[model samples]
Each structure stands twice: as structure tokens, then as C-alpha cells.
Target: MENKIKILLLEDDDNDALLIENILTTSDLNVEIIRAKNKESYLELLDKLDFNIVISDYTVPHFEGIKALVELKKRNKNIPFIFCSGTINEEKAIQCLQLGAMDYVLKDKIEKLIPAVKRAIKLVTETLEKEKLEKELIQFKRAVENVHEVIFYTNPDGIILYANKAFEDIYGWKIEEVINKTTPRILKSGLYDKNFYSEFWNNIKSKDHFVIEMINRTKKGDLIEIKNMISSIYDANNKLIGFISIQSNISERKKKERELQRAKEAAEEMNKIKSYFLSNINHELRTPLISILGFSEELMNEITEPELKEYAKYIHEAGQRLNQTLNNILSLVELEKKRIEIKYESINLTELLKDLINQYSKEAEKKGLKFITKFESHKISIHSDYEITKKVLSIILDNSIKFTNEGGILLSVRTEKINSFTHPVINIVDTGIGIQSEKIEHIFEPFRQVSEGLTRTYEGLGIGLTIAKQLLDLIGVEIKIQSQLNKGTMITLIFPTVAKEEEIKSEVEKRKITIVEEPYEKKSTNPEILLVEDNPGNRMLFKKYLSEYFIVDEAIDGLEAIAKAELKSYDLILMDIHLGSGIDGVEAFKRIKSFPKYKNTPVIAITAYGMTDDREKFIDAGFTDYLKKPIMRTELIETIYKYTYKNN
Candidate 1:
């Protein structure tokens, strides 16, 4: 292997051995020769020395070159052996060559010795390099076969040259059957059109690295989705020799993706249907409920008989309950759909709880239960959505009053420093029929209620807490509840940020400033009102109510309302949305507002479209104010008086 060759020679004649060394030294092979004359020294030296070439005399006194060549063959060394004999028969020379001697040079014509030695060195070097390369190739094959991904290589002609073990296992084919015997078309499933195949071939040839998702079939004809990557393998001369492909099975993943897509489409369809149903149901139910509640309140006021008045009161109360339930359902939908907007404001937590406590106190007293409160500080406030905060507390306190028949409800507030920030925490402790420990965790789940004793007296839609929790989470507030069986429940409302005292005072002063009493002057004894309603019964109700305070003019639809408004200037207008097959209230209002005289006149939105978004939509459409239907007498009159009086 080294450039400096070492040769061992078995020669009795030192003169001849010196001659061979001188001839090799003249060449550039860098020769080193050591002489062994006899049989024992010669054979022992052949076994011990790691020389490149062995040269020997054919017939020494005790040594024969034929015997040494036979020994070299037995040792299985690939070293080259040569003979320079004084007397060698034709049969003996042939036998020596057959026994694996590389070449022989006759002593008479000794010029052939250097050429024979040169030939021997070149052959051995080529053989060694070939053997080393074969070992490395085998190791590379083993590594590729052990990976999970399918790996294969093909020649430039698109003929499969080699494939790893994973390729055979995944494709259900033996490696011998595919290698050098098949092309990529053998696995094509024909699921794609001709254009797909054309694209596939073009991309691989044009790009150095190409990846595509393909549906290919196994040997057994089972389709499989795979993501395949092909990269060109180039040789040292910068010529493309072959392509290497790696494939990952994605059949199961693709199946799941298809299923999810279908489910999404189905859900979208259901949402559209639900919106249609909600729209219809809102108008259908609230339209009649408006008449029921309105007429019942009217009857309760005018009826003289005690029994008749009590019946009217029952009708109004039941209508109110239905209206509240409907509101909760729509509110829960808004919260679930993430359509509710959260606007944070500084609110006086003390005054908020006091207002809620005052509102619910009468209900609790009517149930023969005491309502109590303890404010740790009268000045604690929080930066949160005021309406959402009020609604969450209202739900908890209302639930408390409903569940507790005879037990008192205690509402308290205290301030604490959590994580270096002041948080105002409101705790509502009620001695009601408490919930089980296992049920406390699921109290915020929609439409989920736990009745350990299966109490049938409590009534609710069961989504109040769910809505409360979602609204609080949107505003970054936290709530916690602790309860025991029949012992009562303690709920903690943790506000995220505590507002400064200056903010509370500023809000209080703003409210106080708006309460200034001003001298009132009536525009006329009877202010005119244009009542626009499509429903005949609703039209009569509105006209009857407003007729007492204004010279009421009636219009059955938006067209009529616009026509009447053009003919007469009124103090205020009650416009109902969804007026039959004609235009809606918003379009009619826009038309009237186009006139300079009616642009500033108050046109209130009174509609049965009671979804959470509908109220604000009307307000944003430039209505003076919005009032949901199923309207009560007090609410309708008060809203009307606010716009009509405009004084104090």
C-alpha cells in the first residue's frame, strides 16, 4: 500500500540478488530488498515479514521457489509472489503460475524482472481500493433500510434501481420484484387525472427538490395517501445521475382532515338555520307577549274586583318570567358565540352592590327571608365592564333568593392585595339548599344544574351561571364558589383591577351633574305622536296609550308612517321594526330623517327583535333609543316621558 516497497528474496547468489536491487532502485518504486538463502530462513521470513512482494530462486541448495509459492497460497495473503530461476522446466513454470505466482523471469534473460514487478504492484493496488468501496456501500444500504420512511433511488431513465426494506414492507412487494424491474407507474392508482401525472414528472425534472401529496396504490391494490419528496443526486462532474425519493404515509391524517371539514360545513349550516329560527321565534312570541303583558297591566289598574285584579296580576307576572327566560337564552348565545363586546369602565363596587341588594331585597322579603349586607369600605371600586359586572352579581344574587325559601342572604365586599395589585372581592354567602362538592366544578357548564335532593320547586333556564362566567372571563375577572350539602354556598367575585378613589368621585359627580332640575315649559297641552305598527292589535294598544297624552295618528305600515309624517309634524314617533312584507323600521326612519324638519325629532325604536345585537344595531342606525318589545306599561311610559319631557 505504501509507495516505498519492501521485497524479500530467497537467493543463494548474493551477486544476483544485488543485481535485482540495483535494477529496481533505478526505477521510481523505492525498492527495499532483504535476502534469505536457505529453506528454513526463507520459509520463516515469508511467514514473519509484512513485505509487499516476494522474489525467490527456483532451485537453491535447499529451497525451491515452487514450494514457497504453495506456502503463500496456503496463507491466503494477497501479496504478489515472483520467481527468478536459473533452471526451470516448462512444466514447472506452468505449475508455478497455476499455483498463483504473479510472473517469472528467466535468469538468462533477466531484463523481464522489473516489468513483472511493476505489473504486480499495479494489480494489487486496484484490488484493495475495490474491496474498501464494497464494504462502505453495504453499510450505507443497511442504514437506509432501517428507517421507517420509505426510501428508494432510481436511475435517470426512470427505472427503479434500488429500494430500502421499508419500501418493500409498506408497498406489499418484495425488493427483488421492484428493483431494476419497475418504474413509478407501477404504484400509480389512477386517482388523479393525466394533468396530475404530467405535473408530477415536470416538477421532479425541473426542480432540484420536489414535494407533492400523492395517492398511490400498494401491490395489493389498496390506495394510500403519501407525501413524497424527490431530490436529484448529482455526481462529482455535476451531472445528474439519479433521483432519491422519501415517502411518508399520511392516509390516516388525511381521513381525519376530511372528516373535520365536513363537520365544519355541517355546523355552519346549522348556525344559519338557528339564526332563521331565532329571528322568527323572537317576533312570533314577543309580538303576542307584548299584547298580553300590556293589556294585563291595563286591566290590573282598572279592574275593581279583587279576584279579577289578582288574575290580571298573575298574567303579567307569568309574562314577565317568560320574557326573562327568553332574554337569558339569547344572552347565553351571545356569550357563547363571542359576539358580546367588553368595554371596561371604573365602577363604584360599593354602590353597585347596594343597588343590586336594594332591588332584590323586596323579592327576598316577599319570600319571607332577610336580605343583609356588610361593606368593608364604602369607597372600593374596580375597573371592569359595569353592565357585565352588574349582570354577573345579579345572576348570583337572584339564584340565591330563588333557592333560599326561608334562609337569609348576606352580600359583602372587601378589598385585598393579590399579586401586588388591589382587587375588590365581593362575597355572597347564602344559607340556602347548598350544592354537593362534586357538582360545584360543573356549575358553570351551560344548561347544567345539580339537584342532589331533586328539588322540583326551583325554576330556571340553568344557563345563568354559564353566561355569568363567560362574561367575567371576557373582562378578565375571576369567580370562585364553595359549598356544602344543605349548609349554603359562598361565592367570591374577584375584580381584576381596583379603581382609584378619584375615578369613583368623578363618576359620581358626573351622575350628580346630570340630575339638575330645570324649569319646564310645555310645547302644547297635547303633543302629537305618529304610531307606526303593522299588527292591528299592537296598533290599537299604542294608539290607546298615547292618545291620553298626545293627539295620536295611526299608520299600519312603514309606507303609511312615512306618508303621515310628510303631512304632519309630530312630537315623537313610535316605529316598530319588521312591519309585515314592506320596508323595516330602520329604512323608514332613514327616509324620515332625510327631511330637515324630522332629522332632530325623536324617533324611538320599539321592536320585538330582542336579540342582544338587535338593540345596539338600531341605536347605531341613528335611532334616538331602542326598547325591546313585550313592553311593560311603566317602562314604555317612562321612556316616552324621558324623550317627550326632555326637561328634568
Candidate 2:
């Protein structure tokens, strides 16, 4: 089998054309030869057919080898061309070669045609392959230049070597200007110090790749942030050659992050200011309220006329409602701040609910509403914060009594097994003005009220249910409400139960106790009490209420209280927290406790800042007990008797 070769021969002699074909045939190449004796035939062969090689005589009738070569060049074809002439000069041969001729073979040396033709064909094939590769390289360069991200190449010394068009577009710098220039330092915005760059370079050199966010300045001196991903380019022998980097602009993203941080900081500062203002406002309000409530109760107890006593009762009730409103505001603040802490203890749910029912039942009767209780189990126990749970129940029961005008309220309790646990669920059903279905979803939101007009009958700050829901959620309890407008509302509270443990004896003793009437007696020991307060009215009012039962000693501020405390040992010390123009009560208590005689002297914190965490704060400050301001006469006496009489 012979390899095929197509040839276009421009020669006037037919014998010479036949001789050229015979040489190629003997060289194991199948020759497909087309003869063109003149310019007309040569042009026709070139236009009509594809030939691998062209052979022409140096001198024909009018057309020659140079003309043929010039014609092939006009067509812009890459086919190999050679001249076969018997009378060609050396200069003419060099001229033909210079004009893109592959080779020239004399007619006398026609045997050399075979080798010369093979060389020319081999050279053309290599040239075509090289041209194809050059086209692909051009396409690849175009793609890199059109990309959006800034791309650059740098030497191992961090000197810039090459940059794409995107680099110029983004940084406003031509490639000629940046070549051989060191990066980062030229573009540094001075946002970072030398230590930052030192560490960054060390990391990249060790890791061989690095991505970072940095602030830089453009040629226009505008500050911009960029996220740069850099990778080290290495040779096949694992030697570091250079680095390539792709950078994306992130100035807008960084600006947004800074704005959000500023906003967060502003909000935090505002919250601090609000909390401080509320604390001061609470103290100012409670101080006057204590005087009003204390004096009113004293008048109610000692007044002889019926009408005057009723007036005193009204004043006390009004003060009580105002104090409750203040407390609700503080509680909502604490809940929002997430400062309400739950102290879990083993609780007797049955006893706690019964006590709450008894307390609210009298209020229900006063409002001409019947209060009923149903218990499916007598001994229901759960682990929860006893005080918080009691407050939650009181809030629900008070709302029921306040909203109900005609019908009654029913309280029910039961135990059911739910999801591998026995849960104690309490239900409060009221036949009051029920909530609308659409409004039920938002009922638990703070300060939300169903009736919102000046002439509205409901009297509340509308935070009872909000506080109840928050407190219930804190203790891992679930609540459900079902209501119908103008008919009734039922609320269910489900408490997670704990396994039976040893009953808390202290909790049993803390149950509601009725004050027993003392028989008239003349000879008795009078309990000594220390009243530490800054407000003169609060001191006078507290003395008037307490002086009837005990001998009271007064101190105007924490410094005076400390002086008096060291002088004598009292049965109990009532310390007001915010002592004006002197050391605070907490500091005075700490000083008094340093004395050997007053170490165990039971100091109770009587403070106006009665938020949810107030008691915990006092307890942590080494107080034996805590009480909120605008204190009732009964509660005050009971707290004293518990610490004094019970211990004795």
C-alpha cells in the first residue's frame, strides 16, 4: 500500500510532468498529478481542486516559477510549493526561497525531488499544527481578560508580573504602571499595622494558599474593601515560582456590617438609660405611695366614724392599685431583659392552688361573682419555682375576677400522663366577657388590651396575661386558651412533674396563716426593731405602724444606721436600699455584719425597686429576707413574726 499525495504541476513540458509522477511513484508515494501548462490552467486547478503540493517550472512560455509563487501568495494558501528548472541562477533560487518557496530541484537532478517533496510536506504539517495552537492561546487570553474579578500574577518576592484587564478596570491602574511594583503596601489604606501584614505573609508562605479581607485604596484615593483569594503557583518539582490572586470587592458588605454594629451598640446604650430612668422613677413613686398606704390603713383601723373609715378604705385600695401598676411595669421590663431567674423547688401544687383560690375568692365575692374549685387529685406535686408559680396563678385569677360581671369563675386541677411524663394541669374557666377569636393570638403581647378607650370599663395596665405567659414559659410549662366573645374563656396551664422527693418542710410552714387575736395583757416583752430609711415620711410612717407592737429605733441613712446598729443589738433590722447622700443599705449591711454582735442580726431589705430579680440581688447581698415598698401592715408583721417569734 502506497501513501497518496496530490500535486498541481505548472509546467509546459508534458514529458517533464510524466517524469515527476514516475519519481514519486517509485518512492512508494501514489502520485495524483494535475498538469497546468499555462496561467489559465494553473488558476483553474487552484480554484477547482485541493492539492497537497505545487510544482512549477522556473521558465515556461509567459508564466514562470516566480509568477506561480506570487499567485499562490495572493490566494493566501499554506500549501507547499517547489520549483523544478534546468536553467535557474543562484540568485533566482534564493529569491524563490525568500518568496515562500518550499524548495527548488533542477531537471538534471530530478532524483532529489522525492526527498525534497517529503521535507516540504513535513514542514507544512508542523506549521499548520503551530497555527492551531496559537489560535487556542488567543481564545484563552481573551476569556481571562473578560472576567469580572481582578486577577494578577506576582513573583515569589511579591513583585507584580502580570495583570488582567479587570485589574485595570477595578483599581484604575494600567498594567505598565503596576508591573514590578510590590502589592498591598502601595494599596494600603493604613487600616492595619505592620504586625497584621507580617502575620498575613507568614501564614500564606506556610500554607501556600490564603484568603483574606483587607482594606485598600484605589488610584482615585477611595477606600475599598476586598476579599482576596491567593494561591502559590509551583513547578512540577514542587519549587515555588510565583503567586496568582483573585480579588472581589466587598466594600458595600463591610459598610453594612459596620452599620449594623453601630445600631446594636446604640440600642444597648438606650436600654441602659431606660433601665436607669425606670429605677429612679420607681423609687420616687413608691416612696410617696408607702406614706399614703401606711397612713390610710392606720386611719381605717383607728377611726370611730363609719363614713370616715370607709373613706380610708377607699384611699388604701386606690394606693394598692397604683402600686400594682408600677410593679407590672417593672416586671415587664425584667421579662424583656431576660433577667427573670427561676429557682426550682419541690412544690405542692395542690396546696399552692388552694391558697391562691382562697385569696382571690374573697375578691370574687366582693364583686358579686361566685368562685368554685374542682380538684381531681388531692396530692399533686411538681418541681417549679414556688413564688413565680404562685404569682402566675394570682395573675390569672385576678384577671378572671376583674373581667367577670355576672356569672362565675371555676378553677380545676388534674394529673395526666403525657409523653412519658405525668403533668399537672390547672384550668381556670371564667364566664366573663370572653376574648374575640381574632384578638386571642395577640392577647399575650405586652400592654395589649381588648378595650382601648377612656370610657372602657376594664381597669388594668393590661400586662397580667403577658407576665403570666412569660413566667409560665420560663418554667417549661405550656398554656392554652379557648374563648368565645360575649360568652366565656377557659385557660389551661400544664406543669411538668418531677419524681416524688422528700417534701420541703419549709414550704409547708410558709403556707397562709391567719393572725390570731392576742388576749389583753399588760406585762410582756417588747420586741426591738431598727428602721433604716432615707425619706423622713417613710421613716415616720413605718414607725407609726410598727411602734404599736414593738419599740422602734430609727436611722436616717446608711451611715447613721451603721452607727446605731453597732451601739445596740436589735431583734430585726429593716434596711432601706437607696439611702440618700450616704452609703447604700447593702454596703451598711456588709459593714454591720463585720461586727461580732450584729453578724446574725437578720437584716431584711425593704426596697422600692421590686423587679423580679430584686429579691435575688438582696439575697446575694446577705440579706435574711426581702420585701417590696408600699408594704401592707399584715405582711410586714407576719414577716417579722416569722423571723423573731418562730426562731425564739
Candidate 3:
């Protein structure tokens, strides 16, 4: 582009070389010409020096213009090579052009030399600029390939225009496969909904950049989470070109976050269970102790001869109630720990209900409530862990009796056929102060009462519903409740029932109450025994009355008695089923029967767990007799003689 262009003149003919040189020299255009006589010298000059254009003759001594042009190409592929022929032929000129010569000039018509050289120089300058740009393009491609993230360019219509090796690697696809495919159709993992992508585009159109977490798919169809950043690219005229996206895989990070959330939820559930246990345990232990202390003081004072006996009876009843609470609490803990073992058996629902109502009718009468029992038919039976179900039902019905003040408690069992199987539905409805709306949801929650007001007025620990809920849940029975504040609460328990041959045999056996021969012709020299246990205070009260007739051992826990089995031998073991391990007494008897030495031993399971299932579980776990805790002194003595020393 500068003045005085340096042109290399490679012509073997002296006349042509001189004429071309003079043509350029004489014109107003200034140019310096360097002459090479032959192809050898022209190529040598080209190697050592740069030239603006080359003017060469078509015919040389050893090499023609075509050979020299070929040699010029070897030296600089893009340099202008013009052939000046003495007798230029159309065929040769066409051949020159085909060989990539810039132009063919006739030496006789030297006028065209200057103009052709000027045009050649202009074309050569443009060619040089294009080569420079190509070099830069190769460098940029390498930079993109070297990056760790996937970097790609997609056209406005979403066809992938270009992508680096990393992009191909990240998607597990070859470059050719992804080059022209639309982004969404090829790589979407369905994690992004319509709104997600809609907002993505909206932001990009407004702000020219987008960043988001996306789940993308690979060529192999594997899903991966990625963090992507996209920016709009443009041309020099500010027209839309395409977009460049930079993405990094974040699949592992997303997985870790999900795992952490699950662990947090599990910890919260365990904490709730622990909190309930602590509250219920304290209440169960304290209630019976207060009753025993209050009644024992009255009896000790001997205020009235008739009242003294009544005070003693109250102490015994309180002790028995305390013991039942302890057992329930312990059993629940064992169930939570996954330590309770279940024995599945077939049971008759009708007989079980009758026995439960018979035992609880007196207590309901004492509370000024009528006990109503309606067993529709005896045919319905359930396959379950008899002991557990009995305990669960007992807790439910006991709650009804304890809460209802004046109205009658109704227990009804009906059978419904659904899906060709009989479903036994048991309902225990009470006219007690119904659970408040908000508190009803949590009534089955341990130690939770309807109100602080209700807790103060209620004499028992708030574990009956909790125990019922847990036991029913274990046996796949669903317990539902309906209640209105101050109106009433009705609990419905649903259990699957099927007719079985074994249950018929058990029913027939229960119907025949036969007398067995006595072990001794006369009562043993030792007197019959009854054991009463309530809270610690009630335990002392029962001990004073019962110790007069038989040897008595003490236990604060059902667990302690089970442990003490090896140290002492007794004709019978009396267990308070509701000892505040609340269900613990049931578990203790279960454990004792599990051992071969104690499996056949006579055990009298007594408690507030006097529900139908409570007695069934006690018997199923190898108890010879069952009694409700809070023993009546005269009744306790009479029942003892019936079981322990039957001979008259």
C-alpha cells in the first residue's frame, strides 16, 4: 500500500524485462523493480526478500512462465504471479489462469503492465489480511477447547453452531451429533417445567445473560444436574449473532443436599417420641403415690372403725392403678426399641368382648355410668397377635369409662363384607367431655390431654390413648375417632376378620367350664396369696394387708420382677398390667413365657389394662388367671383361694 512498491521482475528475455520496468518507471506511479533473469534466481529472490508483485515472461531458457509460476507458489502460495508472454496464446493464457496466475500480459502491449501490477498488488494485500484472520481463528478455537467447562455456541433458532471438545465430553456425545440439533429437544431432562424455561428466556431477552440450575441429559441418557451461564453474542453492527453457554456439572452436590434433608427429618421424629415418654412416665408414677399416701394416713389415724376399713380398700385400689400405668409405659418403650416379639394367633371377637365388659361393668357402675355391650354375631374372628390387640382395645374402652361421668358407655362389634372378606368394626362410644377440636388431633399423642383443665380433673396419666394407638398400628388395624366438645367421643377400630377352624375350637373349649382335680386333698399348710402394687406408696399399702396371709416381694418395675424370677419361687405371680411401664407388664409376662423354666408357671395378670385384649394377652402369654389392679380386699382373698388353694 506504500509508494514505491517493490515488484520482482522475473523474465529471462532482456527486452520484455526492460520494457516492463520502463513502463512502471515512466508512469506517474512510483515503483522499484528487482529483476531475476531465470526461475532459479526469481525463486531465490523470493526466499530472501518480500515482494509486492511478480512480473515474469511466459518463455524462459530452461523454465517457462508456468514453471516459474509453480516455483513462486512453492515459495509464497498467495503472492501475485503475472505472466508476460512475447506471443501470448489463448490456450497458454487460459493455462496460466488455471495455474492460478494473477493475469497474462503481452510484452508488445506494454501499456497494460502498469495497470495489471496495480490490480495485483491490491488483491495480494487483501489475501494477506485474510490469512492473518485465519491464524487468530485457530488460536481462539484452541482457547475454547482448553477450558474445563462445556462452552458452546447456538444459533438464534437453537441449532448448535459450534462446540468445544469439553462440551461434547460433558454431554457424552460426538461433535457431529450435537452440532445442528436444538438445545431443548436434544438435552432436556424434564426437570425444568414450562415456567422455568419461560422465565429463563424472559430474563435473557431483558438482561442478555442467564444463569440457573438445570437438569440436563447426556447422549447415553443419563441425567445430570448442571449450573449454566449463557450470554448473548453479537456482531460489529450490533445484530444478534448467537449465544454462548458455559456449564458445569453439579449432580453430586444436589445429591448431598437431598440426603441431609432426610436425616434432619428422622432426628425430629425421634425427639418427639422421647419427649412424650418423659411426661407420661412422671404423671403415672406420681398419681398412685398420692392416692396411697392420702388413704394410708386416714387408716393409720383410725378416725372411725367403719371408715378405717374403707381407707385400707382405697389404698389397695390406688396401688393397683399405679402398677397398671407402669406396665403400659414400659411396653411402649419396648415397642419403640423394636424389642417386643409378637405371637400371632386366631381369636374369637365375641367371647373376647363379653369377658372385657364383664370385668369393666362394675367400674363403669362405680363411675355412675351404664356399660352397654352389643356383639352382633360371634362368627367374626381376626388373625393377629391376640395379646397386643387385647391391650390396645382395653386402653381404648378404659379411656371411655374413665372419662364418661353420667352417661352410658356402649361397646358394639359389627361385621361388614368388603372385597369378599369380613371386616370387624368395633365401636366404643362414651358420653364423656368430648375432646376439643384442636386437641383431638393429638389425643393419641403420649401424655397429651385435651387441656390443662382436663389434666387436673382427670385422675389417671394421659397414656391410655397413646398405648391404644401404638398397639393398633402394630397390627395393621386403623383407629378412627369422632368427637364434639362436651358432647361425646366415639372411637372406631377396624380389623380384618376371616373364618378359621382353630377359632371355632377355641370357642367350644371356652364354653365348657369343667372342674379339675385338686393338686392337694386339703389346702396347702400355706395360705392363699394376693399381691397389690401401685406407685411406691400404694405398694406399701397393699404389702401391709397381703403380707398377713402370704410372703410378698416388691418390685418398682415389671422388668425388676422378671429379673427377680431366679431368686424366689412363688406359687403364683400377680402382675399389674398398667404399671406405668404401662404396657411393660404385658411384656414381662411375654418374656417369662419365652423361657422354658417359667413357661408353665401360674401368673395372675392384674391391672387397669382390664380391657378384653388385656386379659387375652395376659392369658396368651401363659397367665393362669387375670385380675384388675386396685384389688378389693375381700374379693382379692376370695379370688386367691379359688385359684391357689381350690380344695374346700
lDDT of 3 by residue, 397-497 (tens): 78888778889899999977543335788999999989888888899887777666533777766777887777775665768899998889999887844
* Per-residue lDDT of model 2, residues 216-299, tens digit only: 888888888898888889999999999899898988877876786678679779987877787778789999999999999999
Candidate 3, residue 409: the lDDT equals 92
Q: Which ten residues in a row have the lowest lDDT in candidate 1?
A: 507-516
Q: Rate the local accuracy (lDDT) of all candidates.
A: 0.79, 0.81, 0.72
Candidates sorted on TM-score, descending: 1, 2, 3
Give lDDT tens digits, candidate 1, residues 465-505: 99888777666567889998788999998776443445433
- Model 1: residues with Cα > 4 Å off, grouped in runs: 1-149, 156-159, 165-210, 217-222, 236-240, 271-279, 299-311, 336-338, 344-354, 365-384, 405-429, 452-457, 476-479, 492-648
Q: Give the residue spans of candidate 3 off by over 4 A.
A: 1-304, 453-455, 497-648
lDDT at residue 629 of model 2 (Cα atoms): 71
lDDT of 3: 0.72
Question: Where is the poorest 10-residue window by lDDT in model 2?
Answer: 507-516
